[model samples]
Every structure is written in structure tokens, then in C-alpha cells.
Target chain A: MTERADCRASTVSYAAGMLREQLLSPTPVDLRAFLMRALRPRDCLVQVGGLAEVSYHGRAASTAEVGSYLVMIKRDGSLQIHTPKGVKPMNWQPKTDEITAVLEEEQCVLLASRRSPVELVRVTFLEVQMAQALELNEEAGFLLTGSEAQMQETLAAHPELIEPGLRVLNRELLVESGGIDLYAQDAQGRFVVVELKRGRATQDAVSQLGRYVASVQRVVGTGVVRGILAAPSITGPARKELEGRGLEFVEVNALPLVEKRTSQPSLF
Target chain B: MTERADCRASTVSYAAGMLREQLLSPTPVDLRAFLMRALRPRDCLVQVGGLAEVSYHGRAASTAEVGSYLVMIKRDGSLQIHTPKGVKPMNWQPKTDEITAVLEEEQCVLLASRRSPVELVRVTFLEVQMAQALELNEEAGFLLTGSEAQMQETLAAHPELIEPGLRVLNRELLVESGGIDLYAQDAQGRFVVVELKRGRATQDAVSQLGRYVASVQRVVGTGVVRGILAAPSITGPARKELEGRGLEFVEVNALPLVEKRTSQPSLF
Candidate 1:
């Protein structure tokens, strides 16, 4: 019989309960243990404690590999531990203070401090393959760039369409080495950074873009850096406030290549 | 000629800046303006008042269908209208005090007394589309009962797997009215409602599932209603915390119809 969507949902819930039971039972698997099980053994684990550290074969490695281990921390006392795969389970069990101490002694220093009393500790494997699969190739970089040369070429060809004194800069350096949507210079020689947003825009993106601008100003001098964003859209008021901050607002026609099919395939 | 990644990035940045300048220049045709010009005759105009409302040609149903609008209440107690799509030039400024008074007259209240003098208002289109779509499936009771039957059949074999009392009931009852995801029950007579998650797992899922539970409980009894989620997989800790509250968690196994693609597409 064709498995109906409701049936699929219920069965999935049942499977989930089974998994939960397996995880929360007395012989609970901690977040690290769960990760060791889900990810390839070679996949390194990093714990960003007071400082960042890597763990391998149950031993803390002296050095950390580039993007080797996934970092997880509970923002509040929520104590969330997101693994490369997703959330993992913590070997949390109801134990008296004495038993807890004994177990802590056995587990490791990481498990010793119950900062938030480990309300729940889970380690779900993240789809790390996606991160691994993400290749910063010429296509991604070129698309990510708000370069001057490229803009110049377009402007040169479409001179009648664009204005004069617009200078385009490529891969404009920001303080932190994180992905920037785009960075450019204005006619007045002031820098204008444009961050292109495709998916659901987060406060983090705006805040981070602000940081990039701040960083650039810190390096180049104050009042030199400005910010802008080009997306198919923005939520209520974001565009205005972003513009109000002296960040220019420019709307671009979404390139045809930025389509949904690049992400998921659907049956027609 | 090979396009250096840096070079491409620079080109993109430059293009973005040039585009921004062109859009802001004295008489430039920008995308925002182009869309506005095309849609204006449809009674659509960028709203500058606090409670932004726009009209469209087809049906000016809700606020979301209108052109995006941003209103800023500057420190000088003046209101600024940044309708980038308006026929008026960007620099063709209007009287600030007059506009502010007009906006205030239009019930344009500031976002906060002093904290934020400005707020951006956006017209959302999805809500209208969703409302219209729901109209198509008008037989609410029949649809709900049909969905319940499908859920019951799928969980019949696994009835004993979940809590002892869970079972499907009420042809007229529904788990969710939005109709975006599926829902069902467990063996314990508990109403186990399942939600299909498409995005990456975040604590937000828990809040949303909580809402689903509340909604289902409102229709059913709170004592009998339980919430569960079926995604590709949930992280260990998330699953644990959710389960700790008696909520079920499930992981889905996606397979191809051909069966041959199964091995390659497996999500283990």
C-alpha cells in the first residue's frame, strides 16, 4: 500500500521515540560519544572551550586542523550542542550528587563542569558532507564578488546606461576573513560594501556586514567604509534603516542563475 | 582568458557599486522603480506612513501585496519618505516637517517613543496566497477525516511501538489548519501531532512544535495531545530534550521510486 503522508509522519514519530529512548536511557551516550558514532572516524571534533581545542581518538589534539571539528556551545543555559550532523544526545541521567561526581570523574574534564546542569546533552550528526562539498570555486567566488574590474567591464559596455566616477573594487578586504557578499568604492572614493542575500535574511547577516564595514574603517580610516545590500527582497523596514545608516540601497534584477533548482530537485 | 577568483570578486563588487550609483542618479531606471512604475497604475504605491498599506490591480486584499515601503522618523522630529521606487527623484526631497505631520495625521506612530525613531514596513504577499490557496480545499471536515484515515492506516502495524494509548480518531478533527505539514496519533490514546521540517534544526523548531501541540490540544484535549517532528533527522540533544517532555522524534529515510537510486540517495 502507498504510505500516506500521515502514516509516514506517525511512523517517523515512532522511530524518533525509539531513537530518543535509546539515547536517554541510563546508559546514555554523551554528545561527544554520539558524534564519534555518527561521523566518519577521521572527521575531527573541536571543542571551543575557553579556547578552541580539537579532540581525536578520545584524546585532545595539540593542534587543530582547519575546520576539523565542529564547535557547539549552549548560548544561554539551554546548553545546546549542535554537531556537524545536527543536535546530538548527552548521556544525561537522573543521578544524585554523589553518582554524578563519580560519573564526571570517569567521563572527562569536559563533562565535569555542569555549567547549566546539562539539562539535556544531545549530539546529532550535522550533514557535514555539505560543508565538505562546499567548494569555494571560481563560480562561487565570482558570484560572491562585488568587484570593480567586472563592474567596469559591464559599465564600459553599457556606458550609456551607467553614470561616471563609479569605481568598482574586487575582493575588497574586510577585517575578518569571512564570506562577504560584495564590496565596492563610490565616485567620491568612499567604500561601499554590498552584501547579496538570497535566502532568509538573518540579523546576523546585517550585524556581520556592519562588522565588516567597521573593520574596513578601522584599517583604512573612519568614514571611508559604507555598506549596501542587494537581494530580491528584505523584510519590513530593514531596507530603510540600513539605508538610513548612510549605507546606500540599490536593487538589482536577480540573475537567472540564482534559481531554486540549484538546491533541491522535485518531481514534475 | 582565465578569470581569477579575486578578479571576479572585484568585478562583482564594482558592478554592485556602479549599479547603486545608477539607481540613485538624477534620472536612472532602477529595478525597484521599474517594478513600481509597472505596478503603480494598479493602485500600488509605496506607503510612507507608520501603518503601511498598498493597493494592487488584481485585488488589494492585504498589506503584503503592496510595493515595499520604508518610513523614518528622524531625530529632528521630521518624517522621511524613502520610496526608492517612486517617480520622484531620490534627491528630489520633500518637506520633512510636512511629510512627518501628514504621516502622523495618517496614524503613523513611531516604532518606540525614543529607542527607535524609524521602522520599515513591508507588504507580505505569501499570507494572501496562502489564504487563497486554502479556499480551494474548502471541505474542511472531509479533508481532516481523510487525513486521519491515511494516518491511521500507516501507523496500524506500529500501533504498539509508541505510547500504549495512542490511536487515530475523529474524521472531522484536524492537527493543523495551515496544511503545510502532516500530523497523526500514537498508541497511548495520545494525539501525537507530527510536523514536517524543511530547514536546518534550530531551537525554533521546538517553539513551533509547541504551537502545533497547543493548537491540536485546543481542538482535542490538552491531556491527550502530544507533539512530534519528522525530518531527515534531529540532533541528539534536541531529540532528547523533546523526548524528555514526552514528545516523539523521528528520522525519515528518503528513497527513489526506481529503488536503484536508493543506495546513492540514502540519508544515513
Candidate 2:
């Protein structure tokens, strides 16, 4: 590899290390790009916010939804839910690019892709929303409602969804690139990047989001790429300012939930 | 000095250094204990949802104003409008407790108490608020109107109001003990404390303020101290969270120009 490529790889590795530290905490890694290399083939978006949709390659594919279940990898790398839901462990590694396609083909079905076998798990998005709502309230010990065994059952079944989101995000936002937040595709074949704010949205937050928007827009036409600020509720002044600047605000509470599939048998 | 006192002082000095670095960035500080120590003498109350209020020490005596002005000391030690503003200048040393008492009793009216013989200028609070407001909007080249110069001129003229507000703040909140922000009583004896928000009030921002409040409450009783977030319009989940906690929020269009008067001017 060229010196520049090596440098770039090192930088990515460094970022991945930092991210892993943030998630894993005490479990510090010795490798340079542990996350990038390990999670690879699976593209990961770290700390992304203001994303409207995720695109695959050059196409703005509808973001994949496994019912209402929204999975988020926290800053600490540990999985958490704003709602009460169990995340099951699975063995398959779905090809990142094909995960979206698999979700597209079935209302709730599994598919085998070049990357790995994919399974569509039955879950609800409201669970995630509920978890977020509880987070807003700062309640302690908000646990998952389903048993760990059930979550494991789901994870054992639908392993494809986890890495694909990252892959789709990588293609749309030019993953492995240095920048802020995560990248994805919007509805109109545009890149949609998101900047999350758990606190009050300040000018600094807005500007940070604005930077990500600009960066993504440069690659995807400005019109194709849009910014979505995901927050519990924006303050009046912050809302007034960002909305005035034409940034779309998607209140997570107001976000539509993909219908959960109950009758569909579990792939497990 | 007692061993405990010696240890505490060392910790204070250490904390001051850490604060200088953290507050210098646009990123707001996110510690409760640190804020409590930095804004000494004043009490702080951390409410549910991480909302905080920094109560002025002397507010128990006054009740007309909306609340204390959240002010910050810039890294240079100059006062700013945000918390964890920065470090104080190296040469700066706050007055001792004894001096504070003598000065407070004198109501800072006599020209002899103006600690430094700097020129006096008068500045309208509205303009200062405006400057802060614009800066928070990410507007470039934002300057605090010649308020500092104006304050110099005002001090030169009235000289009597040199420490007009000195009595308003409690003696405990003064810099005598190496505090970061100085909360002095204004001429009217109404409690006013400077609150600093390095950036805008996000959830982290509110958390910082919550720490400030918790610190203040430890000294002053509740219901006496009113608070003014005094930033550009606060927005996002932080706003709702702050409001939900009952801390009064004030959007100042400008900041008050504070002049360095040599001696406290006395109308007498």
C-alpha cells in the first residue's frame, strides 16, 4: 500500500480504537484499527446523527427496518435499549450491502447473501422509542422486557441486520473516510447523515451537524443529501434557528415505527 | 493550615487547571463536583433529570430580580457568558475574605475599594446579551460591543457606583478563595451571579448548570435564588429538561459591560 494509504489506514485504525474504548470501556484494545478491521466487510458508522435514510452504493435505498426494532450501538460499544427489548446473538455474517436487499424482499423473511446468511427477526420499533423516552426521563435500571434467552434466540436467528446497517452507511457516506457522525441514504437517492444530541441543541451542535451535512453533500448532490437532527425535543430557540436554516427535525418520538411481525414464525 | 485545608487547596488548584482546559473548548463541561467547587460560596442544586441551579449566597436577602446571571470566566480569566469559560490570568488573585467583608460593608461605594484603578465604563446589558446571542448562532466576527470601553467611561463618570452591585452577591461567592467566577452584589443589593455557558445549553450544558445549582443550594435556601440561563435561546431536549426542573431561563440580547474600577465608589 502507498504511504498515504497506510497513513489513512492507521488513522482509521486509531479512530476505531477510540470508538472501541468509548464502548467497551475497561476492555482496551492493543491493535491499531481493531474495529475497522474486525467489523469490516461490515461498515460501521460511529456516533451518527441527523440521518434521514441510508443509501446503498450510489442508490438511495430505503433504510432497512426489522419491524419496530431499532438497534443502537452505544458510545460504550455495549448494546442498550431505550425500551424494553432483548437483542439475541446470532452466528451468521450477512454481506453488508445485501442486508438492505434482504429486508426489502421480505415483510419478515430471511435470505442467504454472499456475505452471510441473513434472518429477519420479529420486533417492534416502539420498544426502541420507549427506551429513548425513558432515557429522557433519566430513569435508572430500565431493563429489557423480553428474557435474555428470547433475545439470544432472535440474535441466533437474524444475524444479518447488525452489520448491514453499517455497510449501507459506509457506501452512502463513503465509509472509512474521516469525518463526524454516521452516513446513510435518503429517499431521493441522496445521502442522509444524522447527528445525535442527547442534550439541548446549541449553536455548536447545530454547526457540528451542519459540517457533517456539508461533507456528505459534497459527495452526494446537496439536494440528495439532507441532515436530520434526532433529539427528544428541540428547545424553542434551537428549533427556531435550525428549522429556519432548513434542516429537517425528526423528533424521535414522532418517528414512525415499522410494524412488528407477530404471526411470522421466528427464524430461530 | 490544617492538613485537610492544605489538601483541599491543592485540589482546588488542580481543579482550576483542569477547568481551564475543559472550559476553553466550545464543548461544555459535564461535571457536577467541579462546577460546585469552581463557583464557590454560591450553592448548587442538582434536580431530577440532571437539571441544576447555582444559587447566589446573598440572594436570601433580595427577591426582585428573575435570578442570578449565569456567567463564565474565559480561559484568560476574563468574564464570559458561559460556564467553564476558562482559566483566570496568571497574575490574577482574588481578594481575601477579610477584604471582601470590609468592601461589602462599604457597599463598594467609596472610590478606595475599587481594588484596581482601571478606567470605568458603562455598558448596557442588552447589547452584551445581543453579542452572546449572535455568537451562539455561529455568527462569525461577533464582538461584545465596546461595552468594556463603555464600562470604563461609566466608571469614570459615576465612580460612585464602582461596585454598585457588590452587595447583591454574597461574600462567599467572591473570588477571595480562588474561585473561578465572581458573583458580587450589584448596587441595589439584588443577588446577581454571572453564569457562563461555553457553548450553548445542551443536555450536558444543563447538567453543568445543574451542578452549579446544587452547589449554590448548599449555601442559600431554595425559593430565594432566581436563575437566568442567560444564553442565546436554549433549545433541544436540554431546554425542556431545564424548564422541567424550574430554573428560570432568560435570553439576554446583550451583556452588561463590567468596568474595573480602582476603588469602590460610594454615593455617600
Candidate 3:
């Protein structure tokens, strides 16, 4: 990394950045100590990528098959579990009440939990690959301006705007009935079906949202789903039908935003 | 990495494993060549972890904020994107029709896509972290034994057992109404609500599934989710109610399994 810079442009973000010397090959005790101290500061974004088995319990119970994954702990009390593929996080707790790590029976075990509704995400790292706590900016909320895609980006990035502790599992999710505007889990861990209408929502908007809800209801089988139509305004007819369908409505203004994120430009 | 092993247990999965060197510091041209060749072999699992901007289209449309992520492409025509935290992949396309890489604007751009239903996952690598194609055993599908947790673990690993091309995003996921047995995406790109029954799926099983479905339906506003009740057998009443709710049923056997996977034992 210290090699003299050549004419070629660097594609490496951390060009000369080396993972702390000791971190290159961290021991279990090292990992536990690093995780504890890293979580205490709550300043740097702590990331550990390696082999692990993860399990979650609370709203919906789940246990993942053994594999490698990247575990990120953010200062916002959010712990995101990410697999090597996809834009959606496999399992996540937007904000945790407590995060702790311990070396149990020779292996490093990390537990992140929240109390309100009582949710827990537990991960056991069998092998540590790279455990680096990087300085990442999460408080600089982004202002994205564009069409429905941009709105989805802004809202997805800041789910709190819709509801505190709300997490959008996936955006532009395709389901049988049609493409859903947003697929999310609520604060209480309920599946939230969101239909984002950039302008004033009227007419068929209610029915459109209803169809998507029905499709999910039939498929989700036994899971409660909440349908929400988010827009600046709603028509009386749409509002009336929405109530009959038991769907909720939230007002969202399509404010002109000044883009601030260093996001990837649209693929032409 | 060249260091000799000492008394300390090695935590690195690939301790002496170098990232094919040129891949260590890959240029746009080098990355394209590396990715294309790695994917073509369809033997070694191609993993590229670095700083990149990713977006997904088809079955759903999503654009992620600019950041770093790990991109892994498997021989199974699957592309997984991993964030720093969580067991679930941020975005994924299981069993794609084709995988390709290109150099655009002096940047390494990789695409993994499927023609059927036409889904696509595009990743623009702003910086390549580690691009290594390692030989991973996928055919050695696991055999897990135990109780309900094992059942879920088995299904999550071999989602093909439930249905081909079905990807179980997360297991034991907690939702509002109750804990979902499995959260998966169907081959057709729709959200699939799955309830696993290790024993006879009868009696109030239908009602239980119904509750979970309703929760998800209410939450997923405009998406079609297919509800599936999987178990060994079902009573006539349960079957009747399942259809009445438009929920489909699949039969699964809880046969005594012989544990074979190099799986980690339950953390005491």
C-alpha cells in the first residue's frame, strides 16, 4: 500500500488504509475486547465479516443456516445483518437497547437486543475475518430529489420519518399482484405495506393499494399486514374505501430536495 | 498472510490465501477479466468485497445510498449483496440466467441477471476490496437434525426443498402478529409467506397461519404475497380453511435426520 503512486487512478477507498496491525489476525479474546470497547464509544461503525451462525427472536422467530456474513453495528443503536448479495438486509434491528459481546466456550458470541417490544438478534462468530471499526457518517441524513425511486431512497434511508424504529426491508419489491412501493416492518415488528404516491393520492389509488394488500394477505397467511397510502393528500372516496379495507393513510409531501448523498448515478 | 502458524488458533478462513494477487489490487480492466473468468468456471465461489454502489430491479425496484458492500456471485447463478450487519442479504437474485462484467467509465461494473421473469442485479464497483474466487462446496448440501430450529435451518439452506428458485431471506423472523417461520421470495419475484409445521398441520394450525397472513397483508400494502402452509399432513377442516383464505398448502416430512453438516453446536 505504501508503494509509490503511479499514473493509474486508485479504485481503492482505503488506499493506504491498513486494518489495525493486530486486527489483521484477531484472536477470539481480541475480538471480544475489540467489540466491547468499539460498542461503548458508539462513534465508529463497527464491522465484522466472517463465518457465523445467526438467530433472531421477537416478532417473528428465525435462525439462519451457517455461513459467512458481514455484521455492522452503527452508532444509532442499529445492528444490520448483511449477506453477500442483495440490497435488503437479511435480518436487522433498527435500534437496540443493549449490545454486548462475550467469548463463550471458546467462540465469540454477540447479542443485540431491544426492550420495548422485546426483540433479540444473536450472532456467534466462529471465525473472524476482518473486524474494523470505521468512521462512517450516519447522522448526515440524505436529501434525495427525483421521482418515486428517489422518494423511496430518502424514506428508506430514514424510516423514522414514517414511524420510529420502522425498517423498510426492501424497496420496489415485486409481488404477484404488482410491484410494491415499499415493503417494511413496523416498530412492533408487523409487516407494513406502503404505497408511496408522490402527488395527491386520489381515485384508484385506494383500490390499487388494496389489491397489493390482498395479495400479501393471502400469501403471508396468518401474518398481520398493515397497508398505508402515503401521499400529500387523499380523496374522500379513496379515504372511505381505505377504511373499509382497514388500510391506514399517512400524509407525505413531495418536497423539492437538494441531493447531498454521494449516491451512484442512474445506470444509463 | 505468509506468516507461519503459531500456537494461537487461526481465525482467518483463508489465512495464507491470497486474492489471486492481481485481484488484490485490480484495475477496471483487471476486475472485468477477473470477474468474467471467475464466474465462467462456475466452480469456485466468486466473492468481491469492497466499496461499491448497488441497485436492484425486477420483482422490485430499489436504489441504495452510496456506500460500501460485499458482492458475492455463486456458481448457482446467484448474486448476493452483503452489508456490514445482519444474516440477510441486502439484495439478491437467486439462479440468474446470466452473469456479466464490464468496464464502464473506467469503473468495474458487474451484472448478474435472469431472463425468466427478467430480474436483474447491477453493481457498480467504485472500489474493489478483495476479489477472490475460492472453491466452495455447494453440492455438499447439509443434513441438519434436531427440533423446530433444525427444521428451519434445513429449509433455509435448501430452499429448493420448498420450491425451486425460492430464497429464504430470513428464518425465525419476528413480526407484529407473531413470529414468521420463514420469509422468502418466490421465483416469480413475489413475497411468499411460509409457515412450517414439523408435525401434522391441522386443528387450529389454519387459524394460526391466518393470523400471520393477516398481519403481513395489512403491512405489505400493494404487494401480492402467496401464503403457504407446509407440513406433513393436514386435516380436512384445516385444508378447507386454508383454501378459503386463499392460502396454499405444501406437505413436508419431519423425518429423523442424520446430522452431517460441519455445523456449530448449540451455544450453551
Best by DockQ: 3
| Candidate 2 runs further than 4 Å off | A1-168, A171-178, A253-268, B1-268
Interface RMSD of each: 27.0, 25.3, 9.4
Two-way DockQ contest, 2 vs 3, winner = 3
lDDT of 1 by residue, A1-268 (tens): 1222222122101111001111111122243344333222322212221111222111111122222122222111112221121112112222111111111223312221232232212222211211110010111100122233344344434422222454556553434424454556667877766665543344334545655675577677757777766544565445544554565444443322212555554211
TM-score of chain B, per candidate? 0.32, 0.28, 0.52
Per-residue lDDT tens digits of candidate 2, residues A1-268? 2432222222211221111221111011212133233333332322111101211111111122222222232222222111111112111121222221112222211221222222222121111111110011111221122233332233223322222222225422332222444455544545666655543455545555655675566665547666666544677655654675577665432212335569765222
| Residue runs of model 3 more than 4 Å from their true location after superposition | A1-25, A40-53, A60-77, A80-94, A129-268, B1-25, B42-75, B80-95, B129-268
Best by TM-score: 3
DockQ (Cα-based) for each candidate: 0.01, 0.01, 0.08
How do the predictions measure up, each by TM-score?
0.23, 0.21, 0.45
- Which portions of model 1 miss their true places by more than 4 Å? A1-166, A176-180, A200-204, A222-224, A253-255, A258-267, B1-268
lDDT of each: 0.32, 0.30, 0.68
Q: What's the candidate order when arranged by decreasing TM-score?
A: 3, 1, 2
lDDT of 3 by residue, A52-112 (tens): 7888766555677677666777666788766654444566898888898988889888998
